[model samples]
Target chain A: MISFFKKDFLVHWRDRKEIIISLISPLVIIAVIGIALPGWVENPTKTLQIKVALVNADDEQAAMQEFRDSLAARSLPDDELLDIEQQLEQLSPIRMLKQVFQAEHVKEIVSMEELGNDDALQQLQEERIAAVVTIPDGFTLAALNKMVWNDGEGTALRIIAEKASLQVGVLNDIIDGYVQKLNVQSAFHHLLGADAGAAAIASDDYSGIGGREMVDGVETVTSFQYYALAISIVFALLLSVTMASKAITEKRERTFQRILLTGSQPFHYLMGKMSAAFCLSILQLSIIILISHFALNIFPGRSLLFWLGVSAVLVLLSLCVGALVVLFTALVFRLHDETANGIAFIFSLIAGTIGGSFVPIYILPDWLRSAGEWTPNGLSLAVLLQWIQTETVADLSVPLVKLAVFAIATIGLASWCFPRRGRI
Target chain B: MLEAMELRKVFKGRTAVDDVSLFLDQGESVGLLGPNGAGKSTTISMISSLLTPNSGDVRLNGVSIVSKPQFIRQVLGVVPQEIALYEELSAYENLKFFGSIYRLKGKQLEAKIQELLEMVGLRDRQKELIKTYSGGMKRRINIAAALLHDPQIVIMDEPTVGIDPQSRNHILETVRLLNREKGTTVLYTSHYMEEVEQLCSRVYIMDHGRIIASGTTEELRRILSGEDTLLLKLDKPNKDLANVLRSLAPIRHVEETDNGLKLIIAKHSSLLSQIVQTAESHQVEIINIHVHTPSLEDVFLHLTGRTLRD
Candidate 1:
């Protein structure tokens, strides 16, 4: 295994053109994109504001009264009825929705105004608003029933938009976040009982909806830092493809067959390719980070702890990238076609695009951003950014575990796909 | 000894090697002779355990290596038809890598690499990448890479193809040394009859996925012992003369050569005089005439109606 690793490393090192290209391409892209689009990176939300019309069709008083009457009809005890009524007043879904939009950070991005349904539609068509948030009639009654009693189908918040745009996407994300929080609140209520569930919702962590925490008093990421990290991750992912392409050459030249004939285990050969990719990825990431920091001050005035955090993320990301290399290598050997390289390249491109390596996850729709977080590169990028802001070590645990799992799963799949004795 | 029994291989429903059987005794230098698509590489692959036959078994000594490929792999060194060494790596690096995989390490591996470099006459250029070397130089390094482990059996598939005469000679001498001095069993495959004749004690001739004939050089030559080849060099080509010669009762086959006509006839036939007279009657001048004993080339032509190269 060590011999295979050394050979693969030497082979990659000796290819001067490929090595130079791999090291320089990311820096060039970072420079171009970072310089050309400063606004998108430096202040992503500075010039962007989502205008929304909040049309409240439900009467809070009438819904509370209707809820009380329904409880009376069910013949609940007086103490239980009072307890249910108090919980309803405290956890009104409409009030929660309004509070989310009213948050300071949420207010900075979304400007909401109360308007009638006809007026809201007219303004929306006239491009006066990005979307219209409608609170339907009986929403509070239905939501209270579902949350407190686990009865009846829950009412959904209706969002009407003129078209799908960045502003509309952000607005939809904000609403989606609120709904998810509500569902969690409801689950806690059922699992932990009413008082514990209410206490959980009243906790400081859940106080602000769509609000940003100023960790360690650090400012938000600049365009240069964002692109430097994003492009670095994208190129790091590309290293897997590069390694697999080299494997193709070995296969074509019959060098791989020669190695096999030496009685070397196939697993060792795959691990060798993977180790080379892992080393290359770390090298590429380190070089890019150091150069960008020294030359461009991408991570200006960062502490030792910050650098250590970056290193940890780099190692985990490299492991995932290495595992990806073996998967691509296995596919290259199994398919035995020219398109194997193309397939790997396409996969990297798609992963980079969706994983927020090409674009910031904040700008993506809620669903897409969630998916991007699941991707190795995307997860790493998010964690690294968080590390930059918070300088906190505790946050790395979940993402690191996820990255390790990704590595293990990919390596397992690669082993399954790799050709065995007779197949080779 | 290494033996392949009734080996057969098919790719995408097309038979590649069909019921081929051959064996190599310990310390013997045997040749597998065939044309480009005669299944030589496939047969070599199966024997080396790099490829499994559809329905056949290869054995090392008395064990069936088909079910236990490692048995053969341990003792086998395969020099593939293609240059399998890493082009980006130097000759020394390639040798070191291959040697290390076989569990050779430390000073022993370094010395083995040095010895191989000297044997292939590339010691001075060991630091240069294989991509910078000439075709012959690359082929020499390729051969050196296979010998690093000092396996008991070496299977070479057209090792001398597309190489300079000097490198070809060097490779052949290396094989001879391994077989004669080192007592390594060899299975060398090539379409060049002379190389086989010079290096191998026995040869197996294959065509269309099957061995057409196999025997010692002298024994294969005896297939046409009753026949002799007649060469008539004329000033120019004359199809009419060839036809006229073919019609003769003594001549069995007549073929037109570039500068003359060749005839196969009974041994010790007195047809030279009659052939010269016939050329004279046709008003074509006979440049030269010679009677030659049959060779392996003639034997292949006699059996397959085509030259060995074809």
Candidate 2:
């Protein structure tokens, strides 16, 4: 084992490192973009997110008193009420929305870092806040009073920004409009003396019945994550292809062949190559981890399940890829001339692309995304990115199965086609 | 002992080697002779278990290598025709690696590497990368690498193909010494007749993919003992002039040369004037003419029609 490592390390140092830098492109890109932008990886969305503190002024009890409330106090809701009774009404959905402030967008997101200590609303200038909703503490009382007395100040929501970025304006406007409509509807119901009207709106019969309910009726359907997934898989594939070619070169250079002739079985030789590839892949994975964690800080806010899930899937995927590369590269050296190796390189590139290395599957045409999503690189990236963001394993099984199928196919390809005596 | 019995190999749609049989007794040295693409390397590959023959079998001692190639490779040392060793690695490292392959390690591996290095006269230069060495030096290390495991039967495929004469001679000498002192069986293959002539007691001559002739060196040479070879030096030896000289029956073969034509004849008197008269008719100038006894060149000419090298 020591000898194997020594030879592997020497080969890496003496030939590979000198011929080309190790994972230099990833390192450089991660560093340059990471340091220069400091947010590309962290903020996959290129635009600055609008960050505003929710200024609530409901005349409801304090948050501490609210936290103490127990739904258990209610008699187990009668089964009939559970189905159609005015129902156990829930807390109001907050006014969660974004507005494009154009020039003020960047300030809106970054300036909140100092907002906690302000003695005044001095920074509450129109340009300083992209959009503001001053929910007066009497908002709930006013609505109740207007409903009960049929006369009072109805709550108002307004925008403060002079300019609006398109999507931000639209999404934020939609969310704000939703909050207003819900308030009005609830106020209207209270006029009839029915306190549970909020439930009626939530269980809307005429909304986007295509899927799950959305906040403010805005659903975030996307293909962006698919593209990012491709990026990760493509890099891993690049590593695998090089490793496979390097295996043959390592053997021909008389590094491991000599060992094999000394009584080590053919299996031992194969194992050694496998071991080297494993170590290299794992090391590359670590570098990526470091670059992502510290350099980009992409995962700081990510849940532990998300991080674990992504790392686990990627590492295993890389391992199988490395193994397949080794077997094929050795086969190339032994039988076909150098041209086969060239062709393999092209295959790797093509696989990466079709697998969604460059094109994220989401934006791809529906048919293409479906095809790409099932591809090894494409699927692996898709699942991993989803895992990282959602921290859930809901759709991971398909990618895992696809990965296993790919590995098995590659192994069979190598075992059947690789020539035994090509090098000797 | 290493024996290759009626070995045949085919690739795709073509036969590479056909029914070739040969042997090297313990400590004995034999050579396979052929031009380029004569399947010499292929035969070596099969013998070393680097290849599987389509028909026939290779035996290390009396055991068939086809069924159990692992053990066969253990006792066989192979120095390929091309420089198979890594150029980036030092000669010493190459030897140690090959030594370890044969399961020689600790002091034994070191001593073995040192001894082989000394034998090849490359001990002082062993620490240098193989690429740093000259062609001859690389060739020497290549041969030494084969010896690291101290295999009972050592095989070389055109071992001295691209080496300086001095190193070539050193390799030849080393093979002789290993055979004499250690009783190592050697299967040497080469295109150069003289190298085979000097190192091998028996020679197998092959053309295309089949061995056409096989016997002791003397026995093979004796086939053309009745003939004599003549050197007819000419200022301008043209093909037309060669054709004219070739018209003489007793003159068997005529190869054009810058200075003259080298001819092989059955008898001296019957063809000398015919050759001179023919040269005059073609306006060809004869530089010098000398007659000598038959050598491997004549044996090849007699057998292949084209000179051994064409």
Candidate 3:
């Protein structure tokens, strides 16, 4: 077994063309894609700057006074009226809308300018701004009345744009989410009681609505990191085909028959090819990552524990590649044709395509993306991306187990497909 | 001793070997002689346990190896017709790997590799990659790889095909030394009759997936002893002269050669004058005429009615 392994390793190592192709091809692709399509991999909104005209017609103080007068007219108890006033002060719809727009993340992508209704419309028509957001008169009073009494028709925030664009779509979603939250808070108040509703409105969770919170200091994945890992995995998958191609040569040359005559077991021969692919995959991935990190800082300032996690993932991914090599080798011997390499190549290409190696998982259709996550490379890329961000050891468990299962299942299938004694 | 009993092999509805049976005694050098499509290689494959016969069993020392191939694999070394070696690796590396697979290791493997390389006359070029070597050099190394384990039996299938004379002579000499000095049983197969005649004490003549004849070289020669081979070199083409010779009573078979006509005739028959008279009557000049005892080539031609190369 060791002899077979050593021979396979030496054969691959000595083939300068194959080695160069395995290592250099991925690095070139990663560099090119990373430089060419950073925004696609990174935050899509980073390159989009949406300009909006804000028309604030409702006066906050007047709306509050009107709400108080209406409450007094109803002859409600002073304590309940005071509590309602307090809730109104904290949950002013106009003020909250302003805060949502003023959020740092929101401000990064959207620029809002206050203008009169006429001027805002004019700007929108001229395409100087992406859209016009209008807070109609009596909005706050109407909103409060709807929340407390559920008697009056609710006021709606209106947005006018010349055409439906990404900016307008983003603006619409943001406002829609905000209004839904407000309505939810009102429902909670009515269902649970005054104190519960006020508490929900006073939580201030809505203040950071525009930005995502950092959980446990997890960082965002950059384009460099994504392509670095993705392309490396794609190339590593090709290594299995490369190893199988060598097996084809061995069979064509009758070296495999010679080995059999020496009393070497077929299992040992397959394991030798698998071990070679495993080692080469690890080396190929490590080199790609190291160079990418040094040249572009793909994984900057990652902890030792983080690297250890990465190593664990790398090892499992390599094993999966090794198992694929076995399958390809078995196919080569069974089919006794060069088409085995082509079959392995097509398999790798499909896996890479569906596994998010060529594109981000978010862009794929929901079904394909889900399937992609199960692919070894796709799963590894996702896990590595998560590891880069979350650094959570627990997140590694399911993917690691899945990868191991994939490896074992593939090896079992390959063993079954392998040619039996005298068949070769 | 190794024996292949009534072996038959079919490939995709075509029979490659049919009821072929042969054997090798310990320390004996035997040759399987045939044309290109003969079942010699297939027979060797079955005996070496590389292939299983469809309806036969190969035995080693009275033990059936069909169900237990490992029995023969442990002591068998097969030098396939193709250069069955890693071209990207050096000769020494290839030998080391083959030796290691057979359980030789460390200094023992290294020494065995060195010994085989030297024996194949490739010691000085052992470090060079097999791909860099010439065809003959590669073949030499291929033979060396088979001997790395120092097995009790070595099966060579057309090992000297497509090589220069020097390499061919070297490979034959190596086989002779292994058989004579080391007492290694040999099962050699080739289409070249001279190679078999020079190296093998016994020979099996096969054709069309069956063994037509088998015996000592002298005994096989005796199959043609009842007749003699006549070589008549003609200066120019004459279908008439060949036809006339074929019609003669003493001549049993007449075959056209590149430069002449070969005739098989009854032993001690005096038909040369009649052939000369016939050729003169046809106005065909006889460049040379000679009569000799039948060799293996003549024997094959006599049996198959075709030359070995044909």
Q: Which residue segments of model 3 deviate by more than 4 Å?
A: A43-218, B237-256, B265-284
User: Per-residue lDDT for B1-310 in model 2, tens only?
Assistant: 6788999998887999999898887778888888888888788878877678999998877899887877777787788776767666789877766666566789998988888888999888888888789998988887888777678888888888777889988988998898887888888988888888888888888877888888988999898877778888777748888776678777777777667778777754576676777788888877788877666656766888765665
All candidates: interface RMSD: 1.1, 3.8, 0.9
Report the poorest 10 consecutive residues by lDDT, candidate 2 chain A.
Answer: A94-103
Q: How well does model 3 score by local distance difference test?
A: 0.88
Model 2, residue A75: distance off in Å is: 61
Model 1's alpha-carbon lDDT is: 0.87
Q: What tens-digit string does per-residue lDDT give for candidate 2 at A68-95?
A: 2322344455653343233223433322
Candidates in descending lDDT order: 3, 1, 2
Which pairs of residues collide in candidate 3? none
Ranking by TM-score: 3, 1, 2
Candidate 1: how close is chain B to the reference, as a TM-score? 0.95
Model 2 lDDT on a 0 to 1 scale: 0.64
In model 1, which regions exceed 4 Å deviation? A44-218, B232-285
Error of 1 at A273 (Å): 1.7
Question: Which should have the higher lDDT, number 1 or number 3?
Answer: 3
Provide chain B TM-scores across all predictions.
0.95, 0.94, 0.97
Each prediction's DockQ? 0.57, 0.18, 0.58
DockQ of candidate 3 is: 0.58
Model 2 stretches astray by more than 4 angstroms: A1-9, A17-22, A29-233, A247-263, A288-314, A330-343, A365-380, A387-424, B281-283
